[model samples]
Target chain A: DAGVTQSPTHLIKTRGQHVTLRCSPISGHKSVSWYQQVLGQGPQFIFQYYEKEERGRGNFPDRFSARQFPNYSSELNVNALLLGDSALYLCASSSLFRDRVTGNEQFFGPGTRLTVL
Target chain B: ELKVEQNPLFLSMQEGKNYTIYCNYSTTSDRLYWYRQDPGKSLESLFVLLSNGAVKQEGRLMASLDTKARLSTLHITAAVHDLSATYFCAVDTPLVFGKGTRLSVIA
Candidate 1:
């Protein structure tokens, strides 16, 4: 089976511009999560959607928003991008998502590399 | 908010040597995860430890978790150069990550 897939392997945007990155979850998976990773750092969670509902969010700014589709695909949008926003955006998928007691193995996509010039 | 910390942010060892990386989290959580990320690459799931004293092993790497101490460890046995990469441990407060430990296996 195909794993989680992300689109637009690379993107270049100017400051104050907007960008959207897309992800398709694995078959039978219903939860999608977004993460931003800067160089030499671990990924920082942005948003998580389960069954097309917002389930969790991280400390990112309001400029970052995301939504999930019925098919478990997701889009992460960043508005008024800044040079500080330049990083790799990742998408993860899992069949289940309960933080402490329950959760299926999560898988990650290749990620979208975005550069704000 | 929960925080995750990793010790020895960098590791360098000779092939056939063994080393362990440690992860400590601030909150109580039973779910801990280990992931490997190569340069310019996405993360690859390595281990999922769901309970106290949970241990899992694959290939030359082993991961163990202790919920009581809120600690997890990833041990690399007989390291190989191919195993060079950054390793991160995440706690399941909806998934919070550590700064990651970069490992380099030298000849």
Candidate 2:
């Protein structure tokens, strides 16, 4: 009954370096989504994976990518990180894939705060 | 493309007072959600509004959605300091979020 969880609570990277953030969804959850939240702004969706398949993607640059494992865990990778990428990366899990009626409410993880220095 | 807009980017409320936050979206969507985030913290799901005229309430917070107007509102009744945080309303599944409304409650 543990909620969604993410690793490396804090990370500091250089402008050109790459970073990988991991997320473990709640048990029985098959959908995972990634989001980037800038300070003082709402989170922006990055990628969504359902049943270990790419379900949807946001308007983020090609530098941002993500994948889901068979166990419903997920990883978000950012390549050639820019100063603009310095934000909190969040992972959310939902029980259902598409139906909004129920179990589609995404519960979020603690998030990985990435700082590009 | 869906665009979400939230009003009063920042709000300062006195305890025991009442106020409302509004979210307006550009496109039609059946699903709308409200989330709360404290500083340096992740989002906490507050409400999931799925249909037109859907209203859900929890304690001092209430959320309602009007799909026809592409708008949703979060109302705070008798605000308390414990409720201070930034609130965001997102649209659709992929969730196009609006600029959040930061609420600060003062005693």
How does chain B score by TM in each prediction? Answer: 0.98, 0.99
- Write down the DockQ of candidate 2: 0.77
Docking tier of model 2: it is: medium
Give the clashing residue pairs of candidate 2, or none: none
- In order, candidate lDDTs are 0.92, 0.93
Best by DockQ: 2
DockQ of each: 0.74, 0.77
Residue B89 shift from truth in candidate 2, angstroms:
0.6
B1-107: candidate 2 lDDT, tens digit per residue: 78899998999999999999999999899999999999888899999999999999999999999999999999999999999999999988887899999999999
TM-score for each of the candidates: 0.97, 0.97
- Could you give the DockQ of candidate 1? 0.74
Q: After superposition, how far is residue A3 of candidate 2 from its true place, in Å?
A: 0.5
Q: What is the TM-score of chain A, computed separately for every candidate? A: 0.95, 0.97
